[model samples]
Target: MLRPFLMFASLAFFAFSAPVQTPPPSGAPAAAPAPAVPADAAQTPNPVKPTAESQARAKQIYGYDCALCHGEKGDGKGDVAADMKTPMGDFTSSATLKSMTDGELYYVILKGKGQMPPEEGRAKPAEIWNLVIYLRSMSKQ
Candidate 1:
């Protein structure tokens, strides 16, 4: 009798202890939220000067983290990008980044856009700035 009671108690405790998540009423997800870009994002300037060493570090980071979706050449043709419905922007094209400022890029990198998760904690602020510079160079090349 005691063993049976303990089993029932354990079962009740587990059933209540687990988290409960209800499905949405619509049974579908809402649209993706707009990235949190500041009004001054366009005015933000790149504080990190592009040096060979900084660019190299950015390259290493990009290769490991971003190359899966952003391509090795910044051409938006990474392996994962082929599976995505929305195409990644081509950094090799000057027109692709002509309107965006350094700050805007920084915000996108730090906060994330669409399916791209925020790169926060993966790199320092200065390294992100270096990534922006590295991306800009892709168009020039």
Candidate 2:
């Protein structure tokens, strides 16, 4: 009788101890906007010119770090983009590029946004400026 009682108690304890799975809320709050970039940071211009050599180096760096999500051509159609919850922006679009300043792009690259991880330490300041130049060129293509 005691054995049967202990088994029932154990079963009850296990059932209650198991984590309860709940579905996501039907109406979630809207996501907060990205934090504002500092005035000094935003105003800092890209000292690196968009030269052929700089672009070549930028292309190599972009392929290794950004191509996974931004696509080889910067069209926002990279292989991993399909799996991402948020859609990637097409750098090839003039409308998209027109609104963003070089400094803003640099800030985003350094700090990251949403699903993108920060590239601050991964690339030097000069390299990041080169990336900004490369990104600007994408809109012209």
Candidate 3:
């Protein structure tokens, strides 16, 4: 369908573009932003290994879609978040991501929570999983 195609195209465009980094007006809590998810999904483990290719692709995708609100460095201080007055969790901190499994993160991306939009139609499950890996890698930096 055209809708699916459009979604893919837009996603591709964002993936190819550079990310914008802007600090949020204020700091957000170090608390985990774990949205509600089914236990089964939350327990799901990450299948994809952290690789240069996957991380690169995930970075690209995050740059376009997530960086707008989640920040370029995953500090949760993107320009959009500042304007929206959103308290996005900082991925740079270990505590923020410690309690969340890769599956839980994937669920949030696939289904979306709060103002976040689901990547369901726009990206394949593999890509979403890869994104989870990329998010986990943020704390290491």
Q: Best by lDDT, which number?
A: 3
Q: By lDDT, rank the candidates, best first.
A: 3, 1, 2
lDDT of each: 0.86, 0.84, 0.88
Residue 58 lDDT, candidate 2, scale 0-100: 91
List model 3 lDDT by residue over 5-71, tens digit each.
9999999999889687665445543434547899999999988777788779989999999999999
Error of 3 at 119 (Å): 0.6
User: With candidate 1 superimposed using the best TM-score fit, by how many Å does residue 114's alpha carbon deviate from the native?
Assistant: 0.7
The TM-score between candidate 3 and the true structure equals 0.74
User: Which segments of model 2 are wrong by more than 4 Å?
Assistant: 1-33
At residue 47, give the lDDT of candidate 2: 88
TM-score of each: 0.75, 0.74, 0.74
- Candidate 3 global CA lDDT score: 0.88
User: Model 3 segments beyond 4 Å from truth?
Assistant: 1-35
User: Residue 71 deviation, candidate 3, in Å?
Assistant: 0.5
